[model samples]
Target: MGTFKIEGGHQLKGSIQPQGAKNEALQILCAVLLTPEKVTINNIPDIVDVNKLIKLLEKLGVKIEKLSKSTYTFQADEVNLQYLESDQFKIDGRGLRGSIMIVGPLLARFGKGYIPKPGGDKIGRRRLDTHFEGLIKLGAKFGYSREEQFYGVEAKKLKGTYMLLEEASVTGTANIVMAAVLAEGQTTIYNAACEPYLQQLCKMLNRMGAKISGVGSNMLIIEGVDSLGGTEHTMLPDMIEIGSWIGLAAMTKSELTITNVSWNDLGIIPSVFRKLGITVEKRNDDIYIPAHTDGYEIQSFIDGSILTIADAPWPGFTPDLLSIILVVATQARGSVLIHQKMFESRLFFVDKLIDMGAKIILCDPHRATVIGHDFKSTLKATTMTSPDIRAGVSLLIAALSAKGTSTIMNIEQIDRGYENIDERLRAIGAKIERLD
Candidate 1:
């Protein structure tokens, strides 16, 4: 356990670069198992979850070499298939959710894959049915061991077919795509997740000799090939982190610039903040957020109703960012309803915000109403424990803008996603210290 003691009211000013997209890194790193040749990846973030996945890969016999801090070459030619059945592999595989993705590639090439009960943030129920169902559709046999809480899948060979997913789950789509890349025939996936993470995975697969179309849309078509070859890919900037920065800038009244953000891939994130009346300027690929000295305001719908911000599948507002948006709304000029449609318990963190003297009505597990203080009152600092990765960053943003010193416990949750967050924020003039 660790804590972050933050002194509020510091106006941060400077440029900071977003880390590589953690979600994309998870998918792409798992995709390395699709080929035996060397696959080189750049811009891999130095975060706990990602590092844990890398350690799992190493335990599974993937030859890994660190060419630099953010660059690595992975060769799967020497993978130890028998290791999958070992108790050591089970312990390592259960440490992170991304470890589940190795199943798709392993099942495609090695005929069998095993996963212990995976561990991740306890935000809500994240089911693995979509992943296993898609694999089963491609002729894989699936079984579960209740006593051991392990999942196993095997197939003589995977055959391509058309299927419509029940939901556009991002990790589910990535897993299925990796499996289909080496299967026998053509595979068409309808209602696929089209987030930039999945899009980048598809592009990287194509560069490695897989046939996949519909890069930025919900529908995807994959024509299987004999094998994949080595290729180099670079990850995009972490959009979730960029959104957190945008929220942080507004709440602390900081003039900050997020550099090299891959503006085209950000989708509608900037406009979503603009709805809350935050000024966002695009200087080429960089996003500039000026300090909100007069305080931010929320815009009502055209028909004169209090605005509502909710999350849907990608191309829609990302569910990962709603926490930051909810926090930023506490200081806005008007009230807005936040409906977190994807996860049940994600909104419960609002109780912590309410304790900080903000006006929030917890409608239910899925919804809350935030009435902004319009800068008339400053938030009172207090101690809090972060429940998850996204919520940790949101609390840090809130602490930075509060009136006094605030201490946040369980900062390891934040380190799982953000890379050296305290160091980066301190470089931009934020008053935060990490205590072990």
Candidate 2:
């Protein structure tokens, strides 16, 4: 239960670089199991989740070397399959949600894979049906232990086949794609997730000798190969963190530059903020957010209806960012409805915002209506506890813009996703301190 003590109402300046995409790193790291040759990955984020995954891989006997701060070389030639069945593995694998991805590659190359029920955010019910079903479609045998809450998949040889996914789940698509790459025949996947991070995974796998087409679309075609070779890959910048910085700049009236954001990959995130009347400018591969001297205003629909920002699949606004958007709307000039359609409990943190004197109506577990104060009534600092990763950062942003000192507990939630957030915030002149 770490805490953050923030002195609010401080203006920030300077440029901050976004960390490598954590989701992409998770998928790419798991792919190392597909090959025995050395694979070098650059731009890996140093967040808690990613570091934990790296430790898990090291325990499995992968030869890992640190080339630099964000670079690593991995060789899976000496992987220990016996460790997967150990009690220690059950504890390590179940501690992180990303552990579920390891099952795909392990089942493909090693004939079998097992994992305990993976754990992560407790925002809502995140079922593993998509992952298991996709593998089963690719001719892998699935078994579950109800009492132990463990999952296992086995296949002497996977046979690729055409199948349509029930939902365009990103991790599910990645899992199925990984297995199919080593199958016996051609495989076609429909309704596959086409998020930029998923596309990165497919591209990386292709670089490692997998035949995958439809790189940026919902449909994927894979031609199975006997084995994969090593490849060098780099991760994209974290768009969710980029979006968070944008919201933070607007809330605190900071002129901030987010460099190397990979503009083409940020699909519609900028325009979504523009809809909230925040100025998001493009200055060559970087995002430049000028201080909001005059508070921003929310835009209404052309038909004179209240504006609603909701989450959907790829190319749509991401659910991970709805919390930051909702927090930014607190000081804007108008009202907007934030609909977190993906998870039921993500919007529950709005009560803490309301406690800080922001005008918000919690319509339900997934909906909230925020009436901006237009900077006329600044939020008063209040003590709060972080419920999750995104919500924790939102609270931190609110504290930075409030009038008095604020305290936030459970900062480990924030640390799970963001790398060295307090240090990064300090580099941008933010008044924050960590209380151990």
Compose the digit string of candidate 1's lDDT tens values, residues 251-277.
Answer: 999999999999999989999999999
lDDT string, candidate 2, 135-168, tens digits:
9988889999999899999999999899999988
Q: Evaluate all candidate structures by whole-model CA lDDT and list the values in order.
A: 0.94, 0.94
For every model shown, the clashing-pair count is 0, 0
What lDDT is reached at residue 302 by model 2?
A: 98
Alpha-carbon RMSD of each model: 0.7, 0.7
Model 2 TM: 0.99
Worst 10 residues of 2 by lDDT: 119-128
Alpha carbon lDDT of residue 137, candidate 1?
99
